[model samples]
Target: MFGRPTDIDCDLWRTDGALLIENAISSDELAGLREAFSRCAEQAKPDWLSGVRAGTRPAAFFDLPDPMGLDDRFLEIVDHPSFYGHLMAFSEGQVIFLSPQFRTVPAAPLSYVGWHYDVHRESTPLHMIGADLSG
Candidate 1:
């Protein structure tokens, strides 16, 4: 559905506000996302990317040998016009970047991850309900 704002009498930005949903992206946009991810992988240097150690559940990290280089792609995704718009909409206009991490799930015997919240332990209580613009 189109998410274009209408002349409706509602303020969805208030705390505990109800959201007006919309299907923003088309199937083509979904495909583009998949392609971009694949291209990123293809362009990445195998040796520069390494797996993370197994965690309590299952997890592995990609050690971008060059943070600067890998960061370019990460920034691309975060700043991409279309992609960023979609992300902001889904997050209800609340999203911020604290840090970035890359992880890869290789074949069996290597891929594993546990369910966990991304919030920092120290920031608990003030639970990350909405995005915090500052890092």
Candidate 2:
């Protein structure tokens, strides 16, 4: 059989429409993701101040809901081929390589995030709509 899948398909780079692929990751991957996060928290540089401080706004901290123990699974789902295909379909082949992925965790005592576009620069086209996804 083929080795564990690694590369994401190239078709996910469209810039026009929006695509939201739901429930992409597997259950096992979710567990792995959780364990990895826990390990990171344990090993994180505690001396560093949380959030933006001093000249900037401080960062926010929160916990992710884990009832299904699907942290890693969720991540895996997003990275799956079908999700990438959807993203590619939205982009329409105009792929702007940015960060590897976007992630958010809604912890208890949940804070509200304001509705805003991903880009605020003058070059960002006025017609570029923002895509918001939540579970």
Candidate 3:
């Protein structure tokens, strides 16, 4: 089991467009996720992921788009009880899982993503669930 979201978390999501649920998953689950993530990265094409290139922002890191097909563990995260309820609360029951991307920043002197919204075609809503795989 994982941590549940409080009213404050939901409010942050609704107002600030993002929410961070601390200790949402157990350490074991987190370890499993990290392993799965590494496996997925290993299977990726060499050119699929690249460091920031000329004309790109300092934080411009490419993503391994749609990694769910690469591993079943990713699918488990979709409906995982830990943060699923939070998603439901934030979206008011409008839970639609669209893009699942895995992004990583390379070792650099500076790394920072400018403030911006992740917009999809047709102006789709974003309910991003991010994990810090820096460990």
Clashes of 2: 18
TM-score of candidate 3 to 2 decimals: 0.61
- Candidate scoring better on TM-score of 2 and 3: 3
Compared with the true structure, the alpha-carbon lDDT of candidate 3 equals 0.66
- Order the numbered candidates by TM-score, best leading: 3, 2, 1
Tens digit of per-residue lDDT, candidate 2, span 29-113: 6577777666544444242233334423324432333422434444554436645655544456464644343233335343323
**How accurate locally is residue 14 in candidate 2, as Cα lDDT from 0 to 100?**
38
Model 2 TM-score is: 0.42
lDDT of each model, Cα atoms only? 0.46, 0.42, 0.66
Question: What's the CA RMSD for each of the models?
Answer: 9.3, 9.1, 6.5
Clashes of each: 4, 18, 0
Candidate 1 residue lDDT tens string, 15-95: 334443344345666576556555655675443333322232333434333333543444555555544554465566897
For candidate 2, give the lDDT.
0.42
Ten-residue region with minimum lDDT total, candidate 1: 50-59
**Which of 1 and 3 is ahead in TM-score?**
3
Best by lDDT: 3
List the candidates' TM-scores in order: 0.37, 0.42, 0.61
